[model samples]
Target: MTMADDTDRYGRVSRVLHWGMALLILWQFLSAGAHFLLGDTAVEEFFWATHKPLGLLLFVLIFVRVLWALMNVSRRPQSVNAAAKAGHIALYMLLVIVPGLALLRQYGSGKSFEPFGIPLFSGFEGDETPWMVAPGDLLHSWLGWVLLAIILGHIFMVVWHRRSASQPDVLPRMWR
Candidate 1:
C-alpha cells in the first residue's frame, strides 16, 4: 500500500533488505554477548568467527540501501519536524559508518574480511603495532555502541510520534 506521505510502501526488495539487516544486527549483538559470556571456547570462537562475515553482510546491505535511498529520495516520507529529519539522517549515517569501521578494524587487526562465508579479503595484513589495532578496535566498538543508542532513540521517537501525536501510523510509511 502507498503511504499518505507520498512514498510508495517499501517495495519487496527494500523490505527484505531492511528486515534481513535487522536480523543480522540482532544476531551480531547476541553473538557478541555469547562470546563474552562463554569465553574462548569452541562455541564462543565459532560465534567470533561468524562476526566478520555477518558484519560484511551488513556493510554490503548498507551500501545497497544507501544507493537505493539516494535513487528514491523523492519517495521517502517527509519529516514531521526538523528533529525528525536530523534523527533520520543520524540513523542513516550510523548504518553506513558503523559497519564500515568494523570492517576496517577487522582488516587492521590482520584478520580475514569474510561476510556470509565469502572472503572479501584473505590473509590481510596491516600495521601489527598495538597502537594501530588499538585505535581501530576502540573506534569500531565505540561506534557500534553509539549506533545502537541511535537506533534505540529512533525507535523511541517513532513510538512517541505514533502514540502521543495524531499520527498513529508513522511506521507504516516505511513499509509503504
Candidate 2:
C-alpha cells in the first residue's frame, strides 16, 4: 500500500495515524467526561486511571503526526478552503497545547511522572511552582472543553460538507 500521502487520499501511514488518534481521542474524551460527570464513582475511577498516561501517549503521537504531515505537506490533499485550513491548524495547536500544559503542571507539581514506565520526570522537593501549575489549573480543563467543542464542530463540518451539493465530500480523502 502507498505510504506517502497524495492528492487523492491520505496514504497508509496518514490514515493509520488519523484513525488511530481518532479512537484514542475518543477514549480521552470519555475519560474526561467520566471525571467531570461521575466523580467519586466507579466509572470515573475506571476511566480516570488511564487519563494521564493516555494523554502522554496522545502527545507523543501528535508529535509524530505533525512531523509526518510536514513531510507530506506538498503532496497531501488540499484543504477545501481557508477556513478548513485554519480549523486544522487550530486542531494541531490544541493537540499540542492541551497536553503540553498538563505536562508542565505535572512536572511542576513536584511529583514523579513515569507514564508507561518511561521515567519521564522525577519528583522534586519543595512546593510546586506556581507559574507552571497556575496556567494548567486555570486553563487546562477550560481549554479541554473548548477542544471538545471544536472537535464536535470539526465533525459537524465534515458531515455538512459531505451533504452540501457545492462542497466536496472530503471524508474519503482522510478515511480511505
Candidate 3:
C-alpha cells in the first residue's frame, strides 16, 4: 500500500519500536509468571527487578510510538476490516492504560516508583493503612490478566485473518 510519504510499508523506525515493545511485553509477562512460580527466592527477586524496569521501558517506548504514529500516520498499514480496526484501537488503548494503571497502583500504595534504577518518585513512605496495598495489588493483577487475554485475542485474530482470508502479509507490513 503506497502512501503520500516516501517510506517503506513499515519503515525502519516503526519496525524497531514495534518489535522492541513486543519483546518487552513478553519479558514482562514471563517475569511476572516466574515471580509467582518461583516464590520469594533469588530467582523471583531477579525477575521482579527486571519487571519494574522493563515496564517503565515499555511506558517510554509507548510514548515514543505515539509520537512516531502521529508523525507517520500515512505509513501505517491499512486495516484489513472493521474488526481489525477495532482490535488495533483496543490494543493501543490497552497498551497505554495498563502500564499507566500499574504505575498508579505503585504510586497510590505510597511505594517508590523506580524505572531503570531511577526513582520516578523518591523518599515516600508506604501506607500502613488497610486496603491500600490490597486493592492496588488486586487491580494490578486483574488488569494484567485482562491485558494478557486481549493480547491472546489479538494474536488469534491476526492468525485467523492471515490464514483464512489469505492475508498472510498483513502482519509483515508492520515490520516491512
Candidate 4:
C-alpha cells in the first residue's frame, strides 16, 4: 500500500515496474514469435512495427527498475533462496543485454533509428560497422530465445511455488 518498499513486499513502484515489464516482454515475444512463425504476413508486420520502439521503452524501464531496486534493497523482501536470487539476476542481465545488442546493431548499421518518431541516431553513407553488428547478428536471436526459455522457467517456478504446500506463495509480494 505504500509507495516505498517494505521488508514484507514490493511497493507500488516496484510492482508497477515488474508487471509492466512482464507485459512488455510478453508483447516483445509475441512480435518475435510472429516474425519467426508467420513471416511476411500482416500479423508479423503489425507486431514487428512496434518491436523496436517497445524494446527501447523496455530498456529504459529496466534501467529505472534496477535503480529503484538498488534504492530499496534494504527494505525489499528477501530472495527466497540463492537460486531465486540467481534467477532474478539472470533475468535482469538478459533484460539489459538483449536490447543492448539490438541498439548496438542499429548503431552499426548506420541506419536512421527513429523509434516512436524520436530519432536516436542518423543514418550514415558508408558500410556498416562489422564489430558492432556481428555480436548482435550472432547472438541476438539465439540469446533472445534463451531469455524466453528462462522466462518460462521463471513462470514455472512461480507456479510451482504457489502450488506446493511446502513452498511459499511469493506472488503476493508483487501482486495485489
Pick the TM-score winner.
Answer: 4
Give the winner by lDDT. Answer: 4
lDDT of 1 at 95: 73
Stretches > 4 Å off in candidate 4: none
Clashing pairs in 1: 8-176, 9-176, 10-175, 10-176, 53-114, 53-115
RMSD of each: 3.2, 0.9, 3.3, 0.7
Clashes counted in candidate 1 amount to 6
TM-score head-to-head 3 vs 4, winner: 4
Per-residue CA lDDT of model 2 for 54-88, tens digit only, reads 99999999999999999999999999999999998
Residue-level lDDT tens digits of model 3 in 1-176: 33322333677777788788888898898888988799889878877888877887888888888888878776565667888788767777777776776776676666677676686985467454445455546666677777888889888876776687556546666644
Error of 1 at 57 (Å): 0.4
For residue 11, model 4's alpha carbon misses the true position, in angstroms, by 0.6
lDDT of 4 by residue, 43-100 (tens): 9999999999999999999999999999999999999999999999999999999999
Between candidates 2 and 4, name the one with more favorable lDDT. 4
How should the candidates be ordered by TM-score, best one leading? 4, 2, 3, 1
lDDT by candidate, in order shown: 0.71, 0.93, 0.73, 0.94
Sequence-dependent TM-score of model 4: 0.98
lDDT of 2 at 49: 89
Ranked candidates, highest lDDT first: 4, 2, 3, 1
Residue 170 of model 2: what lDDT? 95
- Backbone clash pairs for candidate 3 read none
| Candidate 2 wrongly placed segments (more than 4 Å) | none
Better of 1 and 4 by TM-score: 4
CA error at residue 127 for candidate 3, angstroms = 3.3
**Residue pairs with clashing backbones, model 4:** none
